[model samples]
Structures are given as structure tokens and as C-alpha cells.
Target: MLLVVEDDQAFAGILKNLSHEMGFQVLLAGTAEEALSLARDLTPSAIILDVGLPDQSGLSVLDRLKRNVHTRHIPIHVVSAGDHAQTALSLGAVGYMLKPVRREQVAEVLAKLEARLEQRMHRVLIVEDDERQRDAVSKLLASDDTETVTAGTAAECLELLRTQTFDCMVLDLSLPDTSGYALLETLSQQDAYSFPPVIVYTGRELSADDELRLRRYSKSIIIKGAKSPERLLDEVTLFLHQVVAELPEQQQNMIRQARNRDALLEGRRILVVEDDVRNVYALTNILEPRGALVEIARNGKEALERLATSQLHRELAVDLVLMDVMMPVMDGLTATRAIRENPAWAKLPIIALTAKAMPDDQQRCIEAGASDYMAKPLDVEKLLSLVRVWMPK
Candidate 1:
């Protein structure tokens, strides 16, 4: 759901039409007061806030929302005809879409807004012993322009869970008050409602049994290393996306159908093989929610094995494969070569998921038997259009 707060009636109508066309449920307001009242009454997934409102400035409203406990986390995309992009961003707006907004631009902004909301809507509690590390992780989640709450220790995290709700958690294995595994065990004993998804983000190395045990309770486990902040963010995003993307297709369809009944997809399967967990998770999260069954393989070898073993491949029911280039245990190029060697899988639609945006890289993937190529950090909206093109009605 999105809330559009704009004073101009005609412009508001235009936004509504575009939002509906792009498959978004929109709530409109002509004044800041009305916007605030509606927001207080019913929380929205995202807000497209105009800088100029009749009653008050949008910045003031944004500040109010940030200060309030109830609405602080709802993502806001500030739209303005004026030159206040820097101001909006500095004030904590997720995105600033400039005005005289083109249909394409609006679509792009809304698409990003939806992605940001989807990532954070499932709340995750962060439990870290180090204040600095805890702060850093909190900023990363909030920096993507999403909502997240943090706790410095396991005790605080458990207390937060007792009073509030969360979609998942990022637990540091080494905590001052208690070990991350202990918290996981306690949460598992509780019912599913009290048990949010857990992701272990710790520096500690574990035995295979410990890793398996953590997986039994948590969604994913990440080892904190000397990886760059960007890499860490990617891992976190990947973990969150996987958890949310697991929702039933009917539930996802309901979200789409509520916004636009015309939104339809006759079930299509897209197999994405990417070494980077973040890319795979983000892409899968977006695609699965749109009525596509997404199958993920960590590396090229795993992908090949799945292609050989899956019943769908035997029937030629697998629609597409989004193959990543650089991976362990056989890169995409080698995997594609192996696939082409086989008569049965030679004609499968393969698309390269490459970080190399260069023209030569695209040509290489295509030469390796990929039908097409998409750059890394896949945009949710563009990928949807590409899927529609390949899987035509």
C-alpha cells in the first residue's frame, strides 16, 4: 500500500492512475493534516509525500513521522517540484523523486519504494555485544532507507520481542548477556507467532552440527569477516529477502490483486544461479511475490545438478535460468558450455546475471549460451517486465 500526499487535485489523480496501473493500492490526501490523520489511523507500506502541502510543509510531516513511535519506520519517498532533494534526503527520506515527474520516473520511484518497503516490512531485531557494530548494522538497515530496530545484547532483543513484533533477527553469536544460540533455542520453544525469522551474523566459526542447528532455527547464517560494508549490506539484504519471499503465492497474489485485478501471471518458473546470496535473494524476493516460482542455486555446479534432477526440467516446464558469471565449482561460462553439450537442456532460456555491465561481458554470456543478460543488483520492476516478455500470455 502507498499513500500519496499532494495538494493539487489533478496531479493527485494522475498519481493515483499511475499507481493503480503499476499495481499499487493508493490512499490520497489533499493536505498535510489529512495525510497525518490517515497515517495515524492506518499505517501504510510507503508514502509518496509532496514537499508542498496545503496545511504544512512535507518536511515537517516527515519529521513528525520520524519522531513518532508508531509511524517512524514507514518508508517515505519525497516528491517535490522544488530543489529540495538534498534536504529531503538529509531529513531521512528514503528517496527523492523530482517533480514534473514522468510516468517512467514515477514508475521507477514507486518500484524502488516497494522494494525498500518489502525488505524492511518484515522487522528484524539485531543483537550485538559491541555497541559500534550494533550501531553500524542498524545504520546499514536504516541506511537503505528502511525501518529496523536494534538491541545491544540478547536480553534486550528478547525483551523487545516480548513487547513488539519482528519479521526476523540478526544475532551476533558472542553476546555479553547470553549466547546467540541460547536465544535461538528459547525462541524455538515458543510458538511460531513469538518466533521471528533469525539470521546469525557472528564472527565465530562453528562446526557442521552447530551450523545445521542454527539453520534449524534461523533462516541464514553469516560469518562476520573483513568484508566491506557494501558486502555486509548485501548479505543482510539477501537474508531478509529470502525470508519474505517464502510467503505463499496466494498471499502474494492477494497483494497484487488488491492493487490491480488485471495483474496476472500464468505460473512460470525462473531458476537463478548466483554466487552472491544478496542478488539471488533480492531477485527471488521480487519475482516470487509476483506469481513466479523461483528456484535458487548457489553456484553453477548446483544449478546443473538441479537441472538434471528436477522433474520440471524433464518435462521442459522450467521457463528460464538467470545464470551468474563468477562462481565457485564451475563458473557460469563453463556451466553453460556443459548444458549446451547436452541435447535435452541445450535450448533452455538462459540469462546471465553479471556484475560486468560492459558490452563485451554481455556478448560473452550470450556466446556461452545465454539468451540475454542483466546487470547485477537487479531492479525489481525491470526484471518483472523481462519475465513478462519471455513468458508471454
Candidate 2:
């Protein structure tokens, strides 16, 4: 059963016809009040919600439904002509589709909903060298609808991933045979294995460079602490899309406490070192709205000058540097080496950006003391994620 919540009768009819072709029993609601009533009265498999409504806003309805324990488990996909995709996603919507959508796009959303609803058990893989820690984490995440598999090394983890499918993976950086970074790199290349969203749960604190490397493959990083278990549980359930109502009361409370995302880049200062004006504009656009102060340096020589000037003024000290690999005067590699040479800026985080993401380029960046490397034609979301990860706490 699928709930179709829309004010437009014509479009609702079209959605119903399409759903019928896919063998779904559709229930219609023309307004926010009716939709809420229908949702509470009958819990459907999934919901297709519109942002606009006659009496109230659909985003309000979404928030209400997601907050309620009874209906929070039902996946909601928001369909709107407005630009509310980011807001909808943050509010727990499974997906978002802009209006004037093609039939194929709607069908894709339906297919995803169907796939999620059809899954019976969510499997999680725990890869940790410490036997006691692995068992404890497994016990903490264990549930009736969840199955957990434990592996002691990268080899064992790779074998299990090749043989079976999993919803998520909890990894530790330290392993006897191989590091977690290597395992992730291997998984990215092999198409034979079922790659799952990874949560890096480790006892050790990561350096800026190490953290940058891990960000390429891991979805969330959890350093072990008194409150880490709660956060780990929250992230796992989010990825699994488990029902909050079905979880134990204590677990639910812990999850609630850890659900808030940190404002990583707020009030932070980032120096963008690029010769290209277009990249400078793009980077500024992405960072400024997130409450970051962006400073630009046209070339490597100018970057050095900026750093030197900042050293004399504490208020102008840059928190991070986005270094373009190729520049007119003294390239990114040289700038990075020069930065490393200075004792004051030795540990400063500098992420090198290159047009080519080949192995040679990545190695060159690392050799030049870059904290990490990102390829050109950047993925906007991924770039943001990396920035958040590297941002100093």
C-alpha cells in the first residue's frame, strides 16, 4: 500500500495510474489534514508527499510524521516544484523529486521504496581486531530484525563482503594484517563485492592527514569515548532505516541525544589557493553560506605571502587551505612543501586539488605534505563532507 498526498487531482490520478501498473494499492489524500489523518489511521508501506497544501505546509506534515513513533518508520518521498530538497533530506525524507518530473523519475522513486520495504533483515558487519570490543559492539547493535557478522582482519572482512550482502559495516582502523584504509580502497575497485555504508569506529584519535584519507571511504567516523556507543547506535539505525518505535526505550533515548549533527565549519576560516577565478567563485559559494570566512590567493607565491601575513596577525590565521595542484607561479606541491617547512604551519591542514585523480597525483600530493587530495570537477556534496571532516574542532 502506498499513500499519495497531493492537492492536484489530475497529477494524483496520474500517480495512481502509474502505481497501479506497478501492482500497488494506492490511497489518496487531497490535503495536509487528510493526509495526516490517513497516515495515523492506516500505516502504509510508503508515502509520496507534496510540499504545497491548501490548509497547511507539507513540510510540517513530514516533520510531524517523522517525530511520531507510530509513523516514523514509514519512508516518505517529497515531491515538490520548490527548492526544498536539502530541507526535506535533513528532515528524514528518503528521497526528493522536483515537480514537472518525468514518469521514469517517479517510477525510480517507487522502485526504491519497494526495495526498502521488501527487505526482511538488515545485516551489519563488524571488523575489529579486538575480540572483546567486537563482541561488545555486536551485542549493542544486535536486534531481532538485525544480523551482525564479526571479522578480525581485512582478509576476513573482504571474504564475507564478497560472499554476502550487508546493510552497513563498522570498521576499526587498526588491524593485524592490513589497515582499514587499504580495505576501503580495495572495495572501491572491486565490483564483485557488495559495498555497504561504512562507519569507522576506533579507539585511537586520527591525525588530520589520516582523517582526510579515511573520509574518502567512510560515511561517519566515531572515536571511542563514554558517549560513542550512543552515537554509533544512532548512525547505524539511520543507515539501516530501522523503526525507532521497535527499538528499546533506552536505545531510543540515546539515539535522540546523538542525532544532532555538529556545525563543523561554522565560524571557521578557509583559505582558497587557486589561479582559476571560476573555482574560487564555486568554493566561495559553497563555504560562505555555511558560515565560513573565505580568503582567496591567486597563485602559490601569493598563498605563501598570505600565510606569512596571517602569522603576524592572530585574527587572520587560516584554519584550512584548499590548494590547487597546478598554478602559474610555484604550483600547489611547492606551496605545500614550503608550508610544511615552516614550523608554525607544519601541522596546518592543506587539501590539494588536482584535475587528475590518478594514483601518481595522489602520491605526489601526499609527498608534498598535503593533508589529502580531491579531483577536479568536484562532487559538491562530497566536497562539503570532506570540508566538514577536515575542519578543526
Candidate 3:
């Protein structure tokens, strides 16, 4: 559900219609008073607030929401006819969309808002000592519609968990009352299921044993200060979404079918041809971890050499090749075409790996007879997921 708070009746109606068309239940309010009342009643998934309101300024309403104990966690996107975007952001708006807004722009913002809400609604608790940090984290999670409760200390967090259920926790390792690690130990001992998935956000150094200990409790540990808050949120959002959600039976069957498809040969011998060491390392890291027997060919000549040798051996039939678009001796496009023209490897899966993410580049790669295309710097999780879907178990 979404709350659209715009004073312009026509605009509010348009927003409501668009939101409903986008498959969201939208509640509209033309004045700040109505908006506040509706917000209090609905506890909406996201709020699109106009800076201009009839009863009160939109900024004032936003301030009220943030200051209120009950409404502080609602994600608000400020929309304005005036150029106060910076001010709106500083005042705690998750996003600022200027008027007269395009339907596409609104849709995009709503999409992100929905994704964030889905992430938050699942269940997450934020534990931090600083009020500002707690609010910031809460706001971040709120944007995703993730149900988040903030605790100023470890003791408070434990108390909350005792009474309520949470799927995950974002804990500051340094707490005013008790150590985060000690809290983890305490939670672990309470009951097996009492310990929720935890993400450690701290500046303190964590040893391998500490990581292992957290993992034992089904927690993910991340070093703070190394990444921006946005990046941290992204990682947390992705991790929680993946770890907490179980695949539906239908989706699971689809995945199994994709895994068993004849076109996707199981445990197929793959040759990863790339020049960049980082790309090679990352690909190897993701694929090897997933049980793919990955062999590296640093350049096109080396790749061809491997193919030629494989043809002679008959035992080394390369079922798939991940060719980097750019490399020495012959680029991936040329190499892919060469391999495609050959009868033995014509039907083989040849996916292109390229730094180019533009649509034109993808089209070019397709024209070169590439079976599939993935962009670089590779998303390891996405890569692995795609591989599992395309390749047999």
C-alpha cells in the first residue's frame, strides 16, 4: 500500500491511478491533516508527500512523522513544485522527485520504494547506541518496508527479541551497555531459534574465529567504515532477501527443470577466457565455490590452443566457454565466431563476459554468435544464480 499526499487534487488523482495501475493499493490525501490521519491509520508501505499541503507545509508533516515515535520509520519521498530537493533530503526524505513528475519517474521511484519495503517487511531489528545512527538505520530499512525496531544497546535489543520475532538484525558491534559479541553469545544460549540472522556493523577487527562463531548463529558479519551506508544497506538488503526467503514450490520446480535441460549439460567443462587477473579471480571464486570445474585461458590464443588440444584428446570436450569480449591474440567476438563456425563446438554454450553494459554492446555480442551475455564487474551471486539456472546440477 502507498500513501500519496498531494494538495493538487488532479495530480493526487493521477498519482493514485498510476499507483493502482502499477499494482499498489494507494490511499490519497489532499491536505496534511488528512495525510497524517491516514498515515497513522494505515501504516503505509511508502509515502509520496508533496512539499506543499493545504493545512500545513509538507516539510512540517515530514518533520512530524520523523519526530513521532510511531511514524519515524515510514519511508517518505518528497515531491515538490519548488526547488527544495536538497532541503527535503536533509530533512530526511528518502528521495526527491520534482514536479510535474513523469509517470515513468514516479513508477521508478515506487519500484525502488516497493523493493525496499519488501526487504523491511520481512523482519529486521537495528541495534545501535547513537540515536542518530539508530534513526538513520531505521529510516534506511523503512524505505524498504522492512519492519525495523531500534535498540540503543545490547540489553534493549535482547529484551525486544524475547518478546518479538525478527528474521535478521543489524547490530553495532560497539554498544554502550554490553559488547556485541557477548550479546551474540547470550542470544545463542537462550534458545536455538532465539538467535536471528545478525549483521555486525562495526569498526572493530573481526578474526576468522569470530566470523565462524557468528556463522554458527546464522549471522553475517560486515566491517563498518570500509563501505558507505548506501552500499552497506544494499548488501544487507540483498543478503536478507536471499537468506530469509524460501523459494516457492513452483519456482523450485522451474529451477530444477532449468538445471536438467539438455541444452545445459551438467557439470560441463567450462573454459574461462579473460585477460584481467581480477576478473579471472572473481569468476574462479564464484564458479569454483559452486563446484564448477573452471579452467582459465588468459588470452584468445591460449583459448584456441586449449580448444585445439581438447579436439585432439576427445576426452577434453569443452561444453561451454566464458569468453571475455576484449583480450589479446583475438577478441572474444572473433573467438566466439571461430568456435561457432566449427562443427564440433557449434552447439556449445558460449557466454560473453564484457565490461560493456550498454544495449548496443549486448546486441553486438549476440550478432557474434554468443549464446549469452553477462556484464562486468561481475555480480558473483547473480552469476552463480544464472549458472545454476542455465547449467545442469
TM-score winner? 2
Residue pairs that clash (backbone atoms under 3 angstroms), model 3: 116-144, 117-144, 117-145, 120-145, 120-146, 120-147, 121-145, 121-146
Error (Å) of candidate 3 at residue 76 is 31
Indicate the worst ten consecutive residues by lDDT in candidate 2.
Answer: 218-227
Q: How well does candidate 3 match the true structure in TM-score terms?
A: 0.35
Candidate 3 minimal-lDDT segment of 10 residues: 258-267
- Estimate, for each residue in 204-279, the C-alpha lDDT of model 3 and write its tens digit: 5556466565555444444333324544454344434331124334433433343232122234578899999988
- Give the Cα-based TM-score of candidate 2 against the true structure: 0.54
The candidate with the higher TM-score, 1 or 3, is 3
The number of residue pairs in model 3 that clash at the backbone is: 8
Q: Candidate 3: global Cα-lDDT?
A: 0.70
Ranking by lDDT: 2, 3, 1
- Give the clashing pairs for model 1: 123-167
Candidate number with greatest lDDT: 2
Summing lDDT over every window of 10 consecutive residues in candidate 1, give the lowest-scoring window.
Answer: 255-264
For residues 126-201, write the lDDT of model 1, one tens digit per residue. Answer: 7887888888787666533246788887778877888897755777788888877788887778763366656566
What lDDT tens digits, residue by residue, belong to model 2 across residues 1-393?
A: 999999999999999999999989999999987999999999998999998776445776776676566787888999998866655654557778998989999899999999999998999999999999999899989888999999999999999999998878999888999988889898988998888767788766566677667656533444432337876887677657788878878878877766443334656789999999999999998888776899999989999999999999987989999999999978999999999999999879898899886768877998999876788898665466556545553
Question: Model 1: what TM-score?
Answer: 0.34
Please give the lDDT score at residue 52 for candidate 2.
Answer: 79
